[model samples]
Target: MKTQNQFQLFKERRFLPYFFVQFFGALNDNIFKNALLTLIAFGAFNQETRELLTNLGALLFILPFFLFSALAGQLADKYKKAHIIRYIKFVEILIMGCATIAFWHHQLALLFVILFFMGSHSAFFAPVKYSILPQYLERDELVGGNGLVEMGTFVAILLGTILGILLIRIHTSTLFISIAIMLTAVLGFMTSLWIPNQKTISNPDLKINWEPFSQTWYVLKRAASQRTIFLTILGISWFWFFGSVIITQLYNYNQDILHGNEAVMILMISILSIGIGLGSLSCEKLSRHKVEIGLVPFGSIGLTLITIDLSFAHGLYPEQVINVSTFLSHWEGWHILIDLFFFGIFGGLYSVPLYVLLQSRTEEKERSQMIAANSVLNALFMVVASLFSIALLTLGLSIPQLFLVIGFCNLAVTMYLYKLLPEFLMRFIAWLLINCIYRVKITGIENIPEEGPAIITCNHVSLVDPIVVMASCHRPIRFVMDHQIFKIPLLKFVFQTAGCIPVASEKENPEIKERAFALVKEALDRGELIGLFPEGSLTSNGNIQQFRKGLERILNNNPVPVVPMAVQGLWGSFFSRRYGKAMLHWPRQFLFSKIGLQITKPIPPEEFNLEELKNITQNLRGDWE
Candidate 1:
């Protein structure tokens, strides 16, 4: 459960074999892909031929996801995922063997056929690769597991791409590359043999639908069953769109604009890969081993900023840098390298959380189907990116302009996503507050049940009490709070996204108070966690306020269990009322100041009372204040 170093998963039979299977598969695909692309773009100068080969190659590889993913999802769900993976790897070996023959015979058309089949091989493997993790890994391990997988994926990509570029330029290079891919495929199949098979079938009684179009629609609809899941899917597809655009254009961006050769392109890509590896590794630590979607916006902002900088960073080195050393000799080259590096870093940050969220939220029986839908969407978006890139370039837009345009488009997309579901923004804020401003020690977090309706009673000590409590729980809580809290500029956005119920004193606004209770009832009926400060308001002084009787009102209607919580060590801080007013007086509590959230086991309705709840809160706070 520690999962501090994702590399430890390599020792796990559940994870290690599958890791290699995916790694080798990715490596094999990229090596062949980059080699063919290098041959098409750089091996010849035929304009029409280059355009045709490049477009055809991209289309051929991505088309399978559109056509066969539904079938892949069905097979993965209906049978043993491990068996499907093994069979896919076996197919990969055959595909790579054919690749070798085509390379040997200089059969261009045959190579494309092999590429399509390779795509088919991956299309089948992807659903099983993703969906099996939840079965193999614990909830806490999901983020780290995904981090390792993503890191391995990009690392494989880095090695494959660099190898593809270097090997193709050598004497009898295709011979070497062809042999390498075939051997990789064999290694993939062999490692996949060791992946432990699960006895449980996700859907044994389900019937397979061979129809691609309608089944594709069925899977997509299923994946989008929840609003958050669908939006996450959209966010994921957008990432693919961004990635494909950058990769598809990197060759042209290097040549036409930077006047660089293959070495420069390889160097740029390598930095990006390294950045992604580091970023992916950091997710577990930054998110504290949780599926923190907060990192999504952070990653998106970094991505947009880095890309926009890339547009301006270029044109510094007008002349060609013959080699990597020469490219590094100029600061301008370093700028481009840095831009691409952060691109990878933010990309990893953006994507890892979404995968974790998607996997963790989905139902077991339909997990593979959901992932298949995500894959379909990703493929569609990537195909659109390919076409969009071509159209823009053909329209005489410089690569720099293209980057600028994409960056802005990303900004727009994120804004829309955040608006659609404010949780993304709220989580980002809570994550920042917990990780950056306070060193929080969360105890009794498990007391908050993972499911069912519950009322959380806490002794509020500061304006950020809800935030501290919110950050501690695995599930989202709809906190009942003073409506005036929304009047605060910064806290307003956070509270709004968190779906905090804004209540008022009955004398001040009776209708608002009525509506607040109505919303609370609705949320509890939906099996959500509702957090409210039993003291009714933040302590005007440093002492805990008297518990009001409103707690009984909530319990009367709901009869749900109560989770007693306490927030401590926040008095006199900026958000606490100890310093005259919250946020008005910024006195004390430097970065990472000690803060603690303590929760008691859920008190059943039979045993719950105001006196006992307050006593539990006091004990949890434990003389801290």
Candidate 2:
């Protein structure tokens, strides 16, 4: 059993510096923006000028991505990312210095220009920020790495925004705010110096395109070549869009429908931020470190339902105006708070998997570019969301109504995407079943190799075997499944998203057999683990089948270690032969069933003989046969 302390992940150099850099960046961004927005909101500027300034501030922030994102992607691919990030931080310090001056002089135009420069810095940093994760961490750590980043970013945002608002009351705190922002930038720059230099993967011979918008489309089109990757990016963009809309609306909703003040607004933001932080942390526990995206759909559903409930809870606007203190006395405010919390929880679920997917699937050379593209899309979506909000308001929709409409739209869009790719939903179901119904106890799991290419040969006794391995294995495994099983109603989607490899005998599908062999070789070359069941199909009579030749091909070509494993006491379960069909009946005490996985010590590739390996695996199964 891994103890709670064992999960403290920040000790690794690959993660720590990046974590702090991101943390401080988020902190500085929100602090400056919120302080500026708060000043505008509280009538520091005349009401007529405040709205224009606020609108201009938002436009300046988003415009950089539209103009510079492609160049940012090119730069990230052309140079060492750590160096790029370091320079970006230096730029941030300069921009913050400018912001401090603006704050001192009370120059709104100057502050807005500084905000645009900050956005420019962020546009360039965005790609390197996400693209660096896969370069440093192992595949299994991707989920945890992303979770920490997400949690840290949001926590920083929460603190920055809250502090910005609170500091405004001090009246003489401008110098302190300026100093803090500059220090944050300096600290982030120092941390960037520690980021290991990552090699660029794009074609150096490629010419740079001058036209930004056209180049952006070209980059996006390239990403579109991979259907799953494209959809994943779209999903990520939508999440940002949805988040910006709800958060912006929550501000107005709290002020109007909930009749709350700035403190209540901050409370709403804090709850949502904390909820996401908690949800992001939960992924490590729920997924056991694998990038299980099934949670995305589950989170999306909760976000949709809770958002609608918040809308319904809004009720008719009260004729009597209420202050923040009085609003806290009402039940409706509490309900809205609850809804925001869940919305954030689901938001975390929705975003983390998309990050993992991008890291795992995108090509190394193009990774930063892909991430840059995602950032651009996110910015674009935010712009669209802003427009949507303004349009809805013009249509005489209240903030609460706008929330309901967008929330419903979010649900509709999510459903459409999930229907197109059922794997997202299917993986969620499989993940839920494993987490809820089974408390898997893995024995000899340490016997699995810690590094390098390896084959995990196990018996195929149940439909859930791959998922079980996925849940328990400390490293990522590309399992070879029977070709037909890949077509199983919802199982196909789960398998696809999980990146399972489908295989068949030469007698079954010669082309697929060759393709599977090539994929195994490729994965091995990349030092990834590939799992295969030597028993070509699930046991028909609750006994091991003859070992097949595919294992020999994998071992001979890859020349990697082999770890033999056995799944005990699963042959008669719902998915096994005793049930006669997959999940035909639920066992009365299903949750109590003691399924076991025993892993044998790794056999070096040089010592691995086909017949000998089969015997070793057979022995591990013991009396289960």
Best by lDDT: 1
Q: Tell me the deviation in Å of residue 395 in model 2.
A: 0.9
| lDDT for each residue of candidate 1 in 472-519, tens digit (9 for 90 to 100) | 666899999988886678788888778899998889999998998899
Local accuracy of candidate 2 as per-residue lDDT tens digits, 447-512 = 787678888988888888888876677466789999888778767767886678998778888999
Give the clash count for each candidate: 0, 2
Poorest 10 consecutive residues of model 2 by lDDT? Answer: 1-10
Model 2, residue 334: distance off in Å is: 2.3
Model 2, residue pairs in steric clash:
201-365, 423-493
Give the whole-model CA lDDT for all candidates, comma-separated: 0.86, 0.79
Q: Which window of 10 residues has the lowest lDDT sum in candidate 1?
A: 43-52
